[model samples]
Target: MSSTTTEVLQRKPRNVAVNTNPEHGLHLVESDVPEPGPKDCLVHVRATGICGSDVHFWKHGKIGDMIVVGENGLGHESAGIVIKTGSEVTRFKPDVVFFSTPPYDGTLRRYHVHPEAWLHALPDRLSYEEGSLLEPLSVALAGIDRSNLRLGSALVICGAGPIGLVTLLAAHAAGAAPIVITDMDENRLQVAKKLLPRVRTVKVAREDAAKDLGTRIIETLGTEAELVLECTGVESSIQAGIYATRFGGSVFVIGVGKDFQNIPFMHLSSKEIDLRFQYRYHDTYPKAINLVNEGLIDLKPLVTHRYKLDDGVDAFATASTPGARAIKVQILDD
Candidate 1:
């Protein structure tokens, strides 16, 4: 067996870790420590940001084609330190660490091994908590890129969750003015308002949202938006985004929703609204790190809750509960 396969097969059952499955929700379990392969590094996880997708998987056992089989580690938005480097891992020194992403066991554990290519050096100015945010920030950057947002452009963002709020911040950094954001949860919208006092917040329901939200966006901003970011992925919000956008504008879908959503394609075509979609992300980490280091974007306020690794269950519960007042829940390893 290869080093990777041997490591998984040889792990002791008493190693404390977080395990998730459809049957038992999330619970603390003892799992074997992972061994590093060539070009791999064993990292000691310090902080892991709980993302909406993690909550979705914990609650529903799947997000589209990605499913949790047996007992799976649950986290991707994480930062950690390199404790051991594989024989061929020259890219990362012992001082480096990185955030976790897909197709890898998550970082909600004491230690995990990942390829050196996925590793990025944690800036000296950032704490583990802040570093954990890089993954989400990168997603926001990708969405901003897809929108082709310009400075001082009128913009509307649907959904005020973590992704929505980050997009709002990214837009602000890119000089999007008079930004408006909407969500069904008033608490989340309130958080958005605090982030940018000038940002207009709209609370609208999916019930007849296409008409009501379009009108609300127009009335609030005094005109249709030049760029509409449909971050909610709700069918209704997608439709509202089409209606709320101005002629020749763009509607960027940043949120992951059902496989098939019913959108007003004919209306969007008629208005010459450009429909754009941003899948996860690509090559956004360096820029995200730069923006944070420059103090141009503040991610600290978004971390509303912190839980110890032992409290993984409660953390997921809090994240899943609507109106629980959690913007971002981070799981920390001491």
Candidate 2:
């Protein structure tokens, strides 16, 4: 083979993954960095956000059936720069920072791989720190989309967590007239208020969401919201969503709570309201990036704590803390 060809091929990456077994917490091992196949691009990791799912794996060694076996990487939300691309790659080139997540190797290290379709160019105004946040922001956009949110629609979001706060921002940006947020954590609630100055707060536990809070929110908002975005997957929040939405409005389920909840199908069935289930996100990153680019959405506040890649453990712990009160915990790579 020619020396030039050899040099090009040698630059291709193999993948090294962070593995967690059922018996161990976090174990680091090295493997070949991954090389992109056609339609895929290789990203040099810049920032990876610690998510609740990662913490679940670290503590319990599992999240549902997504067990971390030999050589499995655990992370799904992050942003990074593209370093290599396949022959078929379009819309991006080497060194372009973009958002990568889910069903793709996470941006937790120096390198990760994802399809071109899964990546979105970070806005020029968005830093890697702000860019990593688009993943959660897209989720909030998905919640807004699922709720069929329209202009002047009133919204009630349960849980002032990151997802909830993002939903609040998305709903507000989408021109939903009135939005209310609820959470048990006063600190997180305070952050939510700062992040979204317009969002009304309710200090109610998950279990009491339906019973005590539903009617009160309706009275406060002057009408039952036409849309209820359930960012807290807690059972009672689901109940509140089913009961609190305007008789013929929609409820968007944005959070992943315990396996399933005992939903009030009677009220839902009788009310003829749509109970929409939102998945991670599809084709919404561009809009999310635009939202950030235009200043319609500000993500910097969501990042309450920062760390380097090596501090991943502390990052996950802070993320998992019930009341660390941080909305987003991010890890940066030097």
Best by TM-score: 1
The local distance difference test score of each candidate is 0.81, 0.72
Question: Where does model 2 exceed 4 Å of error?
Answer: 1-18, 60-71, 87-91, 94-105, 206-209
- Residue 87 Cα positional deviation in candidate 2, in Å, after optimal superposition: 4.4
Q: After superposition, how far is residue 57 of candidate 1 from its true place, in Å?
A: 1.1
Clashing residue pairs, backbone N/CA/C < 3 A, model 1: none
Q: List model 1 lDDT by residue over 1-334, tens digit each.
A: 2575346445642345666775746888766667789888877777888888787777777777877777777788888777667888776543224432234456778777878888878778888888888888998999888778999899999999999999889999999988999988999889998999999988886576586778888788768899998887888888888889899999999888998889888888899999988878878888988999899999999999999888888888888888688999998876
Point to the candidate with the largest lDDT: 1
Model 1: lDDT equals: 0.81
Model 2: per-residue Cα lDDT over 283-305, one tens digit each: 77778888888999888878888
Give the lowest summed-lDDT range of ten residues in model 2: 94-103
